[model samples]
Target: MSPISILTFVASLLFADLVNADRVLGAYIFQRHGDRSAKAWPPTKLTSLGYSQEYRTGSFFHDRYISDNSSYQIDGISTDIVNLAQVTASAPQDDVIDNSGEGFLQGLYPPVGSIATETLRNGSTIQSPLNGYQLIPMSDVRSGSGSEDNTWLQSASSCSKAKFSSNNYFNSKSYHDLLSTTRGLYQSLEPLVNQTFSPSELSYKNAYTIWDLLHVALIHNSTASFPSSVTLTDTVMQELFVLGNEHEFNLAYNISDPIRAVAGMNLAGEVLTALNETITSGGKSKLNIQFGAYASFLSYFGLSGLSSANANFTGIPGYASSMAWELVTNDEGTGMPPHVGH
Candidate 1:
């Protein structure tokens, strides 16, 4: 068996440990923030549904990779009272994503309801808050040249080469063809977004923004008042989603230059380096979870040749989506699993 294995979830795919003979070492997880308030509206926050989505994702992973009964459990990971040294998590300080991380951790290490109290050395006893909720520190990944946060989304990082390559797409004959052909489709959306968008903003250029506004309404405000007035038909909404997917994927990657998807390049580098550390340290560092947006997922898929794997890999990932890498080996006694694997 190969020393390295991957478990990925796109959209609503369920979590299941693959049946294999390889021994589990450790894993690295990259997760997208769960559902949140629409970005079209400012000050976006994680909603109840978003929180639940993240919590459920974390719980499923814990069951498969951390629970005692799971055959794939990491060799020496802490199931409770999290050993901060073995597990590490990081997320940008954005409110929605930051809050999403906490929701995931809640399920990863649930409250110790009965073991909440501890006697102090001074004959005083104190109980942890929220019934001994495990408090794990998720480091803040700030925006900068070398920081990991910037690679999670194109907008978070400023890469001149990437910007130039991306802009060239807008000038292509294909882009122009689509823009002219899609006018009618966009115009129909005026009634729904009339107040929020100008006539010019309804074009293909703003496909994602327009789609997101309506999508959130379809999920949360179907009965309530949304931007202008007209309710979107299911067919129209589906088209918008398709258009948005194409638009976003194009911006994140292209055959012209790898610079177009620098975010993916950076992520690949980080994943490789971290995995190497796990092997070198003999699996002392167990699990690493990082949370980010969908942009990185799109680019990573393209760069890693996963875009050809399935329909899901080629499109925008749904909320709470995740991809993981496991360091595995069939060898019982090992200094390091083979440097290369079958």
Candidate 2:
């Protein structure tokens, strides 16, 4: 999809049904960064379209929680007025991830009115140059060995156990089965892969890279840079894409080791933390919290049973897509908590 269209797709598919519960005390949003150039390319950053997409996501939240008549508004906050002190956002210390949060915050709390128009005692007028643009803060969580908060936000690479499982999965019986099943299709795609990357050999192990290239080209490139020989139909591309996605899901989360669940839990742990804090504080916790993470984590989260009760957690969330979790008290008056992931 083009950058513009992906924004609309994300809005309808991801954030449309986030607030269908009773007394949505607060919400936590985990979003994948918006579209960008292929990682293989140097200086991979958010494109103009990506900025627009992320900004739209931020704006969507602003309207839902910051606008007048918002059902999910935070306490001690006014409509059409944002309390920057009450908001919290975090992402791994990567430019793309950082910029994603920044763009979203800009749209969520854009400056609407002048800061000040003051006249000094000496008849000198001092005016602020903010130009009605509000500057909100976003936290940068450390990845790797630096901090624990980013373990899930950067899970795919940070989790050593998941990494070990990934390597083993590549050589497991299941991997062999998948390879045999898609052998024919892989053969057909061999030339395309080679033409694109010209790697030493295009095997099942590295097929996802080829798919990534094709996926990026399909969305970002037109007939200009895309090769004429690379003539895979939409059906063919979809099959390959699904195959790769399934492979990634299995590799990232479904290994035989129990540690495979670490990536999912690390991120979900934050959600649970927020929920618990909110519940403990009499539901007066921060209403909106956003964290950016990789897409593979989304898949792992889907299979982690956190969203199993949720029907909308059927597939992987798309680019700039987000999953919201609502914490609500049960109607039984027994004081049991029901944490709903949507």
Candidate 3:
């Protein structure tokens, strides 16, 4: 072959490589919060058990992405000896358990009984207190004649006197403080509150708060009834997708919202199916399937809703969790076991 012909062939090979690179499938996945104990009145943090669960979840991903030799290869070397890099972001808003500032333990337990009341008929002192702090006539309690010596009357009079005479407590200042705190809390939720978008934006920030709230409630609420005011504001819907690729690609795509979820799942499924089909048609070696998902999401499917008819509508054999399963046969037309790595 001439020099120019050889150079042209080398350039053609590089072009083919570029085209194949662009065709490779990528995936991203987001998961719900990790298992938590019942919310504490003061807002419970993750417990030791919860931390252990998280650690195991992280390890599972690491093994799947970093240690899988047949499935995940990094820099032309097996990832079996390296750990996958993981990053986490947290919710900015504080989880408030009890915002009603009565007392810490007051509402934790239910009230035993109801308070008794008095009825006034002819404006006479009815149901007067026998000793103290009993049901007393409003007139006697407010009267300045000092004939009423009950503890309730004494307490009320003391409170009235203190309000009038003291400079320590100002009602206006207290009201202002309450308003300021409320405004601050509202400001903290500005991201969710201030989302203004056209009909075309496909970003997660546009749909996350609403989707997350609905999804969480749907899975956790006992009633399992849809919220009355649910309106699908956007075209995006949440889905889970499986992908077989390097850990970096998965991290880069990082599914964060319903739109991304559905898109990633569809794209990954299509690409994987196509790749498997190509191997079968061309008589190539079957590629191993190495997949990773958001840790909490795996738990949800394997242990929670995805296993039930109430949660899943269309069920098929070999389909597990939100992932679609398929087998690729070799030239001998022999079925091969799926090599799932992580």
Per-prediction TM-score: 0.87, 0.76, 0.22
- Model 3 per-residue lDDT tens digits across residues 1-342: 000100000011112343332221111222122333322111333334433444454344333333434232111222321111211111212221111101111111112222222456866443323221221111111111220111111121223432242222223464345334434333333343234323232222122223333333334454324333443222222321111111112211222222212323433454355444433433232222222122222222323234243322111111011222222222122222132121
lDDT of each: 0.74, 0.57, 0.25
Each model's number of backbone clashes?
0, 2, 1
- CA displacement after TM-score superposition, residue 214 of candidate 2 (Å): 1.2
Per-model root-mean-square deviation over C-alphas: 5.8, 6.6, 30.1
- Return the clash pairs for model 2, or none: 111-132, 111-134
Clashing pairs for model 3 are 64-342
RMSD from true fold, candidate 3 = 30.1
How many clashing residue pairs, candidate 2? 2
How would you encode candidate 2's per-residue C-alpha lDDT over 277-341 as one tens digit per residue? 66565545655555554443544455565335543333335567766665433232222234323
Ranking the candidates on lDDT from highest down gives: 1, 2, 3
Question: Largest TM-score belongs to which candidate?
Answer: 1
Q: Cα miss at 115, model 1 (Å)?
A: 2.8
